[model samples]
Target: MKLMTKLSMTTLVASCGLASAAVADVKVGLIFSLSGPGAVLGEEMRNGVELAYEQLGGKLGGVDAELIYEDDQRKPDIGKQAAEKLVRSEKVDFVIGPSFSNVMMAVHRPVVRAKTILISPNPAPAPLAGEDCNPYYFAVPYQNDQPAEAAGTYMNDHGIKKVYLLAPNYQAGRDVMEGFKRTYKGEVLGEVYTSLEQTDFSAELTAMKAASPEAVFAFYPGGLGIQFVKQYDQSGAKLSTPLYTVYTLFNGAANEAVGDAGLGVYASTPWTYNLDNPANTQFVAAYQEKYGTLPSAFAAMAYDSLRLIDGSIAAAGSADDLKAVRNAMTSAPFQSVRGDFEFNTNNHPIESMYLGQVEKDENGQYVLSNQATIVEHMPDAYAGECKM
Candidate 1:
């Protein structure tokens, strides 16, 4: 009788273990601007996450993953609705993105409240980095202000004293300008905040031309960037006044749309296609091969987010446990394509920002070539304010 009971107990235990492993499928909600002004950036980010999944063999830490994508349409209300659907209906274990900061701000609270792991591949707004920081939120990219700060510092060091600033009148726009002014030791000829949907920059260009600042700094991403660059080029601004900007302005993805118009522009970014590291080299080549275009900084961040999530799940040993995943993410176990990546107390990436110049590569393609390292292992300014 004892021997028969032991055999039955072992069989039950084996069956239970098999059931657990079989039901270990993870569901992830991916929200980003699939249409509207930010579509290009969103598409690139989507591709990055998709590629990462493929490379992982459709599994994260030995558990199969199902990714549900939602289009936010670059609207805050739409983003909020999408977040609700992902959390309430789908009950996703992890959430990634809403490409722009405005959309992120609209959706962050609900995700945090649900205690779901929310990892942003882009748009690390200032508030989330500071007092509003949440234990459930992690930003795999640099803070919204970091790139702008790098541009400002670069321009200041290069003796560009007077500059004109332009951005969309939004949270990120305001943050970018504030970041620039923080490091810029120059005269601000003027600052213009245009509507997010404003396609034509003729009025802004006229004003910038009139100001005749030594340099012009602008933060227009996706379609807006393409329009701005083409208009600035047509205005003959490239010949006399230089343009110094951040990502989405002078990278391979943007240059494909801006064409020769983006030539001679200087931009600051944490990752570039030309970064000389084995991980980056493999990523750039694989990305180009799969998508038939160069991966942008946006794409790089998305790729990193997936890898980070994968490592966290492995470390935690279970994707369903939010606390374990959060604790594992805080430790940052993955290697980033950017070479050196760590998370600060604010959950923002601590990485180097590089100066890149828009130039033609050997293949005659316009790409941002890495020129120099502008900042090294720079932690976000708001991190100190974060109690987490």
Candidate 2:
């Protein structure tokens, strides 16, 4: 009689487990530069998240997934507030991003303390990859410096010397300039730091022109980039000195706004819309149809982040089991739009970086076209320094 009772209890437990598995919802938290100077990037990222959710039919691994999004406004303090809301109030299973490196740093501590998974769609700053490396943190995009390092090497090979350096007065922008200086053995005529929120670059451009550098390397992203490129063209400096970039030219709205002024400018990136891969082709087509515009690398990164999280949830077999889910995410081998990508020791992406030029596509739309594949299997600087 006792043995019979034990068998009945085991059967009841199994039935309950099955029922629970059938009705669980996966929650993902998304944060980005949703307003101010970096709003365009955030818009692209938000659109990508929406498109991915749409494509997934509101489900991941046969379970309904809910996405909770917040705007960081490119402010660290605001990012921390958003992270708190997502982790505690919303109780999301995973957090997606805070686009800018400064914002990422501000929010990383809180998320790590909560033992929640934070997948960075951007912000591969070096220190986070090394000394501050956390088990719960992962980056979907390549490091902030990798593309810039590749660009530096390309500039050196092209015989560009006496270059002018321009970047926002912030950590990420400074890191880009440092990466470029590490590789390019050129004479830097001047290194200028502008307010990250400032859209006007007239005085800086005038100063750079007076310095008479052979080329200009600018690290402005989003709207600041569009403004800089437009003003540069109007200054007629584009007619002589070559303008080199890292992240400024590839954003969707920025490209359209800058238009012909952006043509002939060179930039480096880890991924572009013109890559000749089946995955990228399908993604581009679907994205354009859904959003009515070309997708930026930021958008692609966000889409890939969702897919990565989804792959982990599927592998874990249950979203409720946090340990199992985290383990699955750590070892995930999900497909990305950028083709092959594997996590480095520091949880950053190990991938290819390309030096691309801005030009008009066959459809007469300005895009990151004529991408010249630069470094393949390029590693980030911080991974080697990390003991983990």
Candidate 3:
């Protein structure tokens, strides 16, 4: 948590009594799991947002911006408290992320209840997309299930008839299974929901191997996915049944730790660091130069989220008007790292999903290779149920 920022505080012109020259200040609250297993993901998000702020010259919408961060500790109640503190106490105009779906669910209430904009950089659960959708809520990332659905569609196109499913026991895990099922018409040989904190996968691996599925699909994230991939590699499951996963290939620590073990594994995501556009190229280079490491999908999405915020505020002429801000956001007035981005009717993203295989780069390090768009302009299934 040391050396958190590289930008200086903004100076206001009002000190000289120049009212016309005074610009509004925007407060952004980041509530992510900065402790426990998900800490790596949280750090990635912070780094991305920080990089965005720095790139924006420490200002948003030509106004001074302040970022307040809080640790949810990977707990529901803790995340809820953080949300309350950000909105009711700190009066943040925008609140972003609790990282995991469970934590996102907990924080959704208070942020929306207080009429603050709840824009998630990641972990857009189904509840927020469907009947429970709120005007104050918006998600920059694709719905939790879109990547899994794209993976399932890819498996079906490849004639993979049977597969085993594994995910952490949580709302997102369930969404992965449901999304995969929605597309893949093949039989599911086995399904396992591992505990969020469980690192060892010996028992689960044993059962999965016994099932002899054509391929294995898993939706583990953060440290949990790192351990699962390592154990799955050690179990030699990839020797026979290939592994298809979401968020494991190009995410921060998970990708680096499971490097070689992840070779030949398949992944689906909305964006990749190696996209062939100038925005992505610039972002990747700047992020690597600043952090001395490749940015993850978490970072990329977070980077886009703040850029969206900046563009929205500018389009609104300032951060003082919520209705104008919301309108500008829905218009999506930003050049995203993804190159192409827009918000759906439900305020979730309508984005293309790509499939990729893990392969060694020219430097002999593992990278997501052979990426291609599998699902174009994919929208969440729950969007229809959203009243707003």
Candidate 4:
């Protein structure tokens, strides 16, 4: 009986040792607007994550990774449902995305309550930057208002005393305009809030033209951006009053669609394809080679999100420990493609925002060339309000 017991104990110890040495599966859930107005941005983000996954050899934190993608359809309720499913049923270890601000706001509560690490590649709403901030939430991208604030500073520096503001009538739009107004010393000729999916901006453009502002700053993103830029060009508004914008106007996806119409426009962004960095060069080349298109800021953020995750997990030495992972994320162990990157107390990025001008390259392709640093190591205005 003693000999049998000793053999059984040896067998159990060997099995346990093998199990400890084996790699575990790390599951990640991605929620984005895969089939709605924001679909283009969503696709770019997906490409970015997938590219990072490939570069990492399909592993995260030295473990096999299983990625699950869910379509939010650009709807808040849909995003919330997707988050619920990912957390409760799919049991993802980490969650990334919910492309737009509205969707992010809806899904934030549930994801936080579940104690899952939620990293946003886009959609840094003002509320989350402030009083509603969550310890579990981390934004790899710039805060929603940072680019607008940069544009405001650039316009102010350029002596643009009068401007017109236009954006969709949503929380994000309002926050961006507020950010612009924060630093802009000039007079706002008029403020126009349009519906989220409104394709026809003729009336708004006509009104904006009549206002005779020195410049126009619009924040129409995705298809809305393409429509607004084309209509603004056809409306001859570009000739009279130059257009300055934030994420909505100048990006790889929008520039490709807008073509020459986007030329000579000024905008603000946290990252651009023209940035002269090794990581950016590699990322741009790989993305273009993989997708047959230039990568946008959306893609850059997505790529950064995965890189950040990998770094965080490595720093923490475990993907399953939520507290350790959060600490590692706050430490920001990875080298961001966008120069220097850091997180504020609110877990939002404190990074530089650049002034970019859309110009035609030698190949006659519209590219956003960095003009200057609009804001350096800028932190969000709401960071003080966040207790955690």
What does candidate 4's lDDT look like per residue over 212-259, in tens digits?
A: 999999988788889899999999988889998885557677788998
Clashing pairs in 2: none
lDDT for model 4, please: 0.85
> Would you give me the overall lDDT of model 3?
0.83
TM-score of 3: 0.93
lDDT of 2 by residue, 1-388 (tens): 2233224323443543422223448877888887787888887887777667667666666577766677888899999999998899978889999889899988999898899999898787778888888888988887778888988888888888789999998878988988888888989999999988888888999999999999998888888888888999999999999998985456687888888899999888888888878878988999999778888888888888888887887898977787787778777556788885788888888888887788888788889874687888887888877775
TM-score of each: 0.93, 0.91, 0.93, 0.93
lDDT of model 2 at residue 50? 65
Global fold similarity of model 4 (TM-score): 0.93
Best candidate (score: TM-score): 3
In model 2, state the lDDT of residue 334. 69
Q: lDDT of model 3 at residue 334?
A: 90
Cα deviation of 48 in candidate 1 (Å)?
0.1
Please tell me which model should have the higher TM-score, number 2 or number 3.
3
lDDT of 3 by residue, 257-300 (tens): 88788888889988877877898999999998988877888998
Native-to-model Cα distance after best TM-score fit, residue 68 in candidate 2, in Å: 0.6
lDDT of 2 at 269: 88
lDDT (CA) for every model shown?
Answer: 0.86, 0.82, 0.83, 0.85
Per-candidate clashes, comma-separated: 0, 0, 0, 0
TM-score of 2: 0.91
